[model samples]
Target: MSYIPPHKRQTKGSPLLNPTPAPLFNMRSDFNKFRTWNIGYTDHTILKWFSVGLDDELRLSSLVSFQPLSPESFETKSGIQPLSLVSTHQGCNEGIKNELIETPWLLIAANVKKDLLLSFQHMKREMEEAVMAQVKPSVVARFGKILFYGSSSIGKDSLKLNSLTETTLRKMKGSFHTDVPPSYMDYVEDRVAENLGQEYVQGKELYYVKLSDKLRTKSIVSCKCTVAKDHNKIQLYKIELNRVRHMVADMSILGKSSDLRLFVNTKKIKMALSDEEINEIKDLIASAILDSEVPSGIRWPLDKRHSSGGRYVVNAIGHTTAKSL
Candidate 1:
């Protein structure tokens, strides 16, 4: 590998220390700056109240939490000793203060100490809530946005001392352009020489996609395709069949490949066939793939259960093919 000099080297930035790493989405700033030597805070400010571990009661990272430094909130944020026990209170005023502190919570926050009461009459929903209910639903989307939203690649390997994704690397791979070439038009013309085909191609022209010198040598042009109008109408018929069910019925599993999708669900298929034999049989189902749409090529008709016909967005290539492919 070539050397990357001092000025060219990308240095690491501090992580955005999530004060409450609980759901992560509940907080935002993505760089950590708390531990580095540049700050107005002292270790005692954090260490004196928080246990160096979790210790969320004193929300430190956000700098904008409501009643942030109070332990006597939400019936006390937690039972950690750093926050004093409320039983030490001395009057009706103290009870009033405690009630005011707990006003925000719908229910009391669970704690190591409070849970030991073992009162069968009580339940903490946050702790004992159904697994499905307490799940952090938005975390996956948030994480994808932070680390991979702008990433690009042809394949997924990289070893050039790059940490962040480089879109330039994808441009380096080969030309990926939308321009339709003249030969591509001819190719498309050859496939559909009918009246409707001529009408579709009558004014449609191809544009050459310019490319970088490294990728210009690749044969990147290919015919673009779309669902033909008549085929599209057939698809509409298929949708109509589903909506007005009494008019059309799906063949029995023993008779044809029902719209059921799993390739392994070979109910109507002959059981003795091997993978090569299956691919060979499926090959008999001539398909003009919408390369722009079905970027992941064809791998269907795993058995001899459906008939073939018509032009097909192929959202579920299984449709139209319940009777035809």
Candidate 2:
């Protein structure tokens, strides 16, 4: 019928009488018989393929996901149906001359158990090392009496390799992007300035606390310093007056009389510190109680600062070997 000229044939119902056009790709029998029925070109999907003398084995791995056609109906309690994938491998004994062969790669891959285990162990060791590098070591070889180590945060702007130098740990921050500053220290008051004029109040005294969030994924090393912020860089030194935690802590008069007292951080505890365990620093106790408003308060020394490094010193009063200046 297609050999006839176009205009010469009947034009009236001829279009309807024409046979149905064949499809571009009419796959049959689950790729057992794959054929292109009509002229068309697809980008990556296979239309038809065959092998004559090729040696390479063909392994077709396709994801077959059966999504619910109707979400509202398929998920009903009464509509629950079992779904599974099972290959009977049955129709092979029909004497078709084409022998069925089991997948050879599956058995071959099972022999690689020893090498696979070794590779897994190697991966585990590397991962453990990376994670432990971010944690603070409980026992460091060189963190002795004096702190010689420092911590600095270097961001991705430089992409420098993180490392531990003679005096510093180069990276201790996190991996998230942020607009706010990482940390503020230039204007933060020092420990001494924050606890001044507090009359024997122990809990309000400033102390360094551990930074917990820096031990996480994408972290490099724990801070190697005694402090996260340097006190010498402080620009503001605001003096704040604090109140006593308890009547027991309001011991300015008692402290002035005795040379021993304990400065505990807890607000309340049943196990009170004894006089034997109390190790009082004269410079610290004087600074905490010094006040201009109260007449009974201790007046601070003229030349001495409110806070500074101190030592536990003792002088010989009557020892025969002692020499006087």
Candidate 3:
């Protein structure tokens, strides 16, 4: 009998025999193209109060207010003891006062100590009320001026890094104009692309983007990606089916072919598949394995058996050696 190579073999009506063409949507390129516009930013001040039970009363141990810190700073500072518990009210109050002495960022009322000795819940409520009552009026008075005048001045002076508006573009053009007018914009775009690419591609993080709703109804299709280090590129895989199915692994001697078994619940699938569909799925799996660039001396056979099952069991065999290519 004549032998044909795996890649050369052609089965009639096999989708794998003629693989589907690549789509227009290149995930990496498309993501980089719109990364800047899709990027989001927010600025806000947070007020936090550390409390500890003293005697039968709850005391506002420490108060701090600041903008959000980086993940590393937050992680490190979160574990630090903000307030130390003392034996007496005088010591506790003195400790808090000493901590707040140089810290002008915290807005604590003069009567915070007087409001102590209340229930934990009540103390938090009263302290929050007092802080807001004192702070809200001042904020309201200055908000209008800040909104109308301060924002414009700040906007003009601050570096607009990722803004894509026409006004921002014009401002950038005026500030960094050279003999080649488009060079600066191109450089900025490339830098933004490089940053995003480094973060998502080079970083050890899996990227999964969901497909459109129009694609399927029950199971939402998604594109999963991982860096193929050997190939020095990203490998994108689509996951369309995610139903909980019984898996049975039939491991054999290393380098020896093992039975590829798939057990599915008929009720879950909800329909009986024609032979053509089964062949297509099998062919697809075979094509994927064939297309994969396996390490030299490794051989993974394209053979599988489908069975209906409620439970599945896996079996392992002895070690086998592979011949070096």
Candidate 4:
């Protein structure tokens, strides 16, 4: 036998160089055929690399080794569901969208990984130079979750449209389309915020747990509140005061204590909040309570109170974390 060169020998099994392509990707096969499908693979080598071409041959050989006589053997060992590979920008975006819908956790994990990788990169540079602000864990965590949520949500509207009936589909197909609302991602967003808040509250006296739906989604509201019959520019801060009476009475005795703070977004106004929006935020904060969730035994109208300096404050009272007076 003539000695075959190593490179030529290796190329023998390669589906690309092989004159007879592997059975899985054979042009004649009806099941795995993609000639008409136009499922674009960036590299033709992708077929050989991922076993898309050789899958059927390998599967058949494995089946024959077992020597099953059943008709099901032919059906099961011969075919595989073809994946839609993409190369173009639009196609890649669609692929990402499809992937996110199928596996939202993957999106979340990817985002988290990306953020962590970025932070570590930043840290590595900082250690060498020693002048940069170290990335905060909370910031990294927030970004990861946001990326995950955003990637996952970009295609939900298309999915909804695809699910519509023919008549409705026809109507929607021609109609002007608005973008998907951001509310679908509120759960993930709330969970991230909840985790960050918990971390922020560690070893700190968490006074006044604000038990309201409006308080959770927003930390600050830079809208005009109708105060005393005038639309006054109000900047409301979300302060979770667990025990308003106890905390108020405690603060009355011993001056104001330290609390975690956040700023309101003056740019986006809460133009119209649904009943669900209010309730969702309320439930999130209530669930964050340490022990009892009941806000009873707190002072009357605890939220609307003026401090000694004539500054407005809203005390969110909850029984989660508290020390009674």
Candidate 5:
């Protein structure tokens, strides 16, 4: 028995990507400028106020908030304190003013100090609200544009890289079929000729336009093949079947060395059968043909369009045979 290696058959057609990732961020300027400003300014202030209360009210430690510095610092920097617990309503009272000064200890012991913390919290919240007011739209707009509409056309560099990658892949895949044995290659070539109703010739391989309903319901040119044994003596066949149906009511069979393949256009076959079951039936029926046990009714209908009598239309092949109940 001669060895038949696994033949790498090259399909002479283009294939598309499984899932195409869409582009994000269309505009360069807007995408870059977005989120440049900090929206956490108010959050920072609130954190500082909490820090202050931890030290002053809770007496947790002597650490003053390094940020949002004390009212005294505000007076020194801006020529005024943000809030005054002391009033100069009395006439030129230096001693009273000195006593009321908002030292760290005074703020800690004040009865209304909780109110001051609450006011500080409210102010921090308001500042945060203001900062986010400016930042939210820019951020929202960036995501909205990306989700609703893809980025503008890709750059030239990216397009060129994709093209190069596709071309290289095709070249690599093309090299695979170049090593297939001539006998195996001939098998595929003959099937193509038989499907197209043309005589099988040497050198030139025949190709058929396969029609599938599910994968787009379109036709694709494919290499046809018949049953052939591998080196392990395992019978193998490659035939294109319609996507919509299970059993093939219509097909074009191509034979090789007494091995015939029933190309079932299962579109008309309403019944279902596993590949193993289908193969078993085909082998059994073909064996019965060799033994002459199959009924005379089992015949290929003549093609009315191509021949005078019409084509061979068998209800079932292999194991599953159709019979009137």
Candidate 6:
């Protein structure tokens, strides 16, 4: 019997949707010849012997003993058919050998375990320290300047002066002169006239005063005054009555109230690994692992030998603690 490719199998259903039956092989003679070679036999050869469809009880017994029964003994088993085993075994062996040749690396880095772990920890710590050194000084300088200045102007042009509204001016006057003496109103009037080139008049109750320029074209300024009841003195000492727009709008209300707080945030700097650096590290670790010999009893499957080595190295490095370096 000749070997049939899965696509060329005589099956009515689709091979993908309904899998074709396992290939049969006349392994009775080959099994006797290679029965003693089980120690060195690969999984591919063992699987072919299994696909011969031996009885469940006999298959289990043979697997346990790691031996193939005689061809005459298989004659008693119903529906036991033998086909070409030599060609299938040769194909399986060629594939297995090619896999072994391609993946000359170990599945696990058992030899360089300590060295790899130490190197990873050292690399992580060095990277963290370098990043902190680069970022800490800039962050500290910016935050310190903000805290020390507390929104003070560094130069004259930095401060802007804006006009105050009549309603806001009235409120300022009321708050400042609420507890001042009647004589304080006279002093305020003199100051207003001297500074603004205006004349101030006292009202009947002295609770508020109206002021106009010398030409009296229109009222230029208004004043409100009151006498203090507790101290019987004036409390209108520093009255500028001007509100300006802030340079930093976010921190505008910082000093307006005693209990108000302003929070300043620094932009976060992201630490990223570039493709070049990632590839460099992977190659470095792969070289280290391949330089060491693989231990016995460790099976280097095709997948592990080819690409999984790099993945394992990355995962191992990531698991280490930078602080513990």
Evaluate all candidate structures by whole-model CA lDDT and list the values in order. Answer: 0.21, 0.21, 0.24, 0.24, 0.24, 0.23
Per-prediction tally of clashes: 7, 0, 0, 13, 12, 4
TM-score, structure 3 vs. true: 0.18
Q: Model 6, 157-185: lDDT tens per residue?
A: 22112221222211210000012233645
Candidate 3 — which residues are off by over 4 angstroms? 1-205, 217-219, 229-232, 237-325
Write model 5 residue lDDT over 65-98, tens digit each, in one string: 1112244322222232122111122234454333
TM-scores of all predicted structures:
0.13, 0.14, 0.18, 0.20, 0.13, 0.14
| RMSD, one per candidate, in order | 29.2, 36.8, 29.0, 25.1, 37.1, 46.5
Residue-level lDDT of model 4, residues 1-325, one tens digit each, is 9997533333222222222222223212222322112111111111110111111223322211111223332222133211111111223344333222343344334323332333333333323432322211122111100000112223344323223222221121111111223463354355765676632222222323332223333233221111122222112223221110000000000011111111111012244555564444433333321222343323333433323222223333422222221
Among residues 3 or more apart in sequence or in different chains, the pairs in candidate 2 whose N, CA or C atoms overlap within 3 Å are none
- Candidate 3 lDDT over residue span 1-325, tens digit each: 7997643444334322211111111112222221222111111111112112222221221131111223332222223211111222233465544432342212122212222211122223223444212211111100000000112223532222222122322222110001222454356356865776632222243333332222223332233444356643334433332222111111111111111111111111213434654444333222222223442211224342211221111111111121221
- Superposition TM-score, candidate 2 onto the true structure: 0.14
User: Over all chains combined, what TM-score does candidate 1 have?
Assistant: 0.13
* Lowest summed lDDT window (length 10), candidate 6: 141-150
- Model 6 lDDT on a 0 to 1 scale: 0.23
> By lDDT, is 3 or 6 better?
3
Model 1 regions lying over 4 Å from their true place: 5-225, 232-300, 303-325
TM-score of 4: 0.20
State residue 62's C-alpha deviation in candidate 3, in Å. 7.6
Angstrom error of the Cα, residue 91, model 2: value is 7.1
Worst 10 residues of 2 by lDDT: 246-255
Per-residue CA lDDT of model 2 for 169-261, tens digit only, reads 112211111111213221222343356632222222122111111222221111111111432211111211111110000000100111111
